[model samples]
Target: MKEIAKISGIAYLMIFISGFYANFAVLESLLDINNPSITTANFINNHSQFGNGLLGFVMMLFFDALLVWSLFGLTKSISKNITYLASFFRLLHALFFGIALFKLWNIYQLTFNASNSVTLQHRVMKLLLDFDTLWTVGLLFFGIHLIVLGYLALKSQYIPKALGLLLLLAAIGYIIDGMAKLFMPNYIDYKDVFEVIVIMPSVIGEFSFTVWLLIKGFKKQRGLQNAKFV
Candidate 1:
């Protein structure tokens, strides 16, 4: 149990690091939602960094898979059936994210085929928007996974109740922000507000949970009495 917890913690850390590098460092500046021409120019000039962003996604996905296995192993002793459900949701989110990466790859490949700048700009912008929209959809599944995982943690002997509560709160943040982005046309007007909503709880809850997994780890379960309802 402890060993799996440690592995899960490390996987979580890598996901954060790689995701940050991909989304913020390599991709953020290149994106101009209102101006496809700017985005096309940026992509042409920074194709190497764009490829690096894809590489970061590769690393994040690899560690993300590791996290699914480790988290399942770490928590199954608490409730075998429930843990399976949680893992399945996470797997779905990962699948969606992988598909999103394909869209990004299409955008990156455009860098090599930019002989027609006008067409390339429009194409790249559409792909970028598609990638963002698809990722928002994936966040919904991720939120659901977090909710179940939080509930399991809440009922566990070894996991902290506060961590469970934080995860639950974070789940709400993600689901709300994701739904808003998909359904609300005025989402841009409140983008900052929504970002903060998701960021605050997610960073605190997920980061603290990761640190806890590394530092304290989990104790072996003595019985399933606590998880009989599962």
Candidate 2:
């Protein structure tokens, strides 16, 4: 159980860092709405950005596969059905992100084929937007996974109840925010509020989990009785 916790924690941190780098260092730094050519220029000149961004998603898929299965293994004794369902949702989220990476690849290909044309620049920008939309779709599955995981955590005597509650709050935020983005035309009007109400909870929940898992690991107790570590 300790070993599993350690591995899961490490993977969690890695996923977080990779995601941060991809979003801020690569995308935020390079992408410009007014001059999409600058974006293309960065992709062509500094291929490392493209490579790093793609690698982050790939690493996420790899680590997430391990993380989800470990979670299922740790909590399945609580409810095998629910554990399986949560794992499935998480796996689906990974699959969605995996497909989204190809959209990035498509953008990269455009850089090589056509970097100067204004129409192509507009197309690239649109593709970037689409990529973000696709990632949000994946987050919907992630939200479901968190909800189930939170339930299992709360039910498990071996885990902290507060952590479980935080997970649930985070799940609610993610689901609501993702749905609003997809369905609500006026989503932009309330985006900042949504970030505060919904996204902040997720960050707190996940970060707390990561820290606890890394430092303390799962609490060993009688409540963990019958829980399969392997």
Candidate 3:
């Protein structure tokens, strides 16, 4: 449990860092929503922008893959059934995101193909928007994983109950936010409010869990309860 927790914590941190850089630093830097022409020119002139974003996504995927089994190892002993469910959801999230990476890569392809065309900017901008939507779609599965994992954490004596509760709240926020973005027509109007109400807690909860796992590791269960849970 200790080893698994440590591994998962490190992987979690890697995922956070790489994902943040990819979205905020690389992707946001290259893509200009207000002026797609600028985005296209930048990408054509400096392919390194795309390269760095791709690298970040690759690193995130690698760490996410590691985290899947490490998390299973940490929680499996608690309840094999619930652990499998949570792991399954998380793997699904990873799979969806892996598939979504193609959309991101395709942005480059579309950019190159449309370089000589008058509609290059429009096409590339549409693809970027599509990739963003795809990312949110993957987060839907991630939300489910968090909910199940939170339940397991609460039930298990090794993990903190407060962390479990926070996870649950975070999962709710993710689900609500993702669903609104994917389905609601006027989502943008309330997006900022949603960010404060939902996204903030989710970030806080996940970051707290990561820190706790790294610092404290997993505590051992004991006696009949431990044996039964295991």
TM-score of each: 0.94, 0.89, 0.90
Q: Where is model 3 more than 4 Å wrong at Cα? A: 112-117, 219-230
Least accurate stretch of 10 residues (summed lDDT) in model 3?
A: 219-228
Give the residue spans of candidate 1 off by over 4 A.
219-229
lDDT of 2 by residue, 51-137 (tens): 787787778778888888788766787888889999999998988887887888888777763447778777778888788788889
Q: Cα RMSD for candidate 2?
A: 2.7
Off by over 4 Å in 2: 34-38, 219-222, 226-230
Top model number, lDDT: 1
What lDDT does the true structure give each of the candidates? 0.87, 0.82, 0.82
Candidate 3 residue pairs in clash (backbone atoms < 3 Å)? none
Return the candidate ranking by TM-score, descending.
1, 3, 2
Pairs in clash, predicted candidate 1: none
Cα RMSD of all models vs. native, in order, equals: 1.9, 2.7, 2.3
* Poorest lDDT segment (10 consecutive residues) of candidate 2: 221-230
Query: Model 2: which residue pairs collide?
Result: none
How many backbone clashes can be found in candidate 2?
Answer: 0
What's the true lDDT of residue 147 in model 2? 94
